[model samples]
Target: MAEDHRHETHPEIVKRLKRAEGHLRSVVEMIEAGRACLDIAQQLHAVEKAIGQAKKTLIQDHLDHCLDDVVGPLARGQRRAIDEFKEITKYL
Candidate 1:
């Protein structure tokens, strides 16, 4: 497994994830209760958006901490870290 160097955990991210979890539970209930398709779709969309926001927060943290630490002399690990950081935005 890769080591996670982005150590910052914003409270807002935790709150959003908690809300997303509630939304997911509601979605399961909707499925069990045979709710309308559109309503379920809307709830799933909300979960997706929440997850995307969390990912953005994590990427920002990586850039701020891990990437900032690599700005010195060009050691091999530093070069690889810089390359990975530059490419990370594509995943977002």
Candidate 2:
């Protein structure tokens, strides 16, 4: 992870990831304790969704703020590059 830009949503993202981390730990413990598979799967799904949402927020923030800074009267090539980068992040 690199930090060339910081946004207001960053703290919120960290909070979400922390919550996901806690949930993951709980899932691990539940597995060790012989919890029902259904219960463990539900917790794992929550953690997965939490992490996915955090990633989406981070990428959207970067595109909205960081790229916006570079969008002013740039040459065509640079703009295309930025667009390409934005497109690639969609896969994340």
Candidate 3:
């Protein structure tokens, strides 16, 4: 059987996502209101930055807990976990 290695969503992560959602909604409203291109672009940049920060936090958490456990002294599962983390980093 495959090992189940899902990380539970931390409360702070959820809060950050909620705040991002609000920012996204504002961006949508700005678009609908025919706001200037530069203004909309600025808001989009803010949203992207927030998402990037949140992603970094989540990645750090995974590295600390899941990856550390997988890559510890045994080294048996290290390669696979490392490969997975590399794949995930590509998207970010």
- The top-ranked prediction according to lDDT is 2
- For all predictions, the C-alpha RMSD in Å is 5.1, 3.8, 5.5
Model 3 lDDT per residue over 25-75, tens place = 989999999999899998888888778778877887787677667666655
TM-scores for all candidates?
A: 0.69, 0.74, 0.66
Indicate the residue-level lDDT of 79 in model 1: 78
Would you list the clashing residue pairs of candidate 1? none
| Local lDDT at 44 for model 3 | 87
Q: What ranking of all candidate models by lDDT puts the best one first? A: 2, 1, 3
Ranking by TM-score: 2, 1, 3
- Give the higher-lDDT candidate: 1 or 2: 2
Show the lowest summed lDDT stretch of 10 residues, model 3: 70-79
**Which portions of model 1 miss their true places by more than 4 Å?**
1-9, 73-91
Evaluation by TM-score, superior candidate among 2 and 3: 2
Residue 76's lDDT in candidate 3? 52
- C-alpha lDDT values of all predictions: 0.81, 0.90, 0.78
Better of 1 and 3 by lDDT: 1
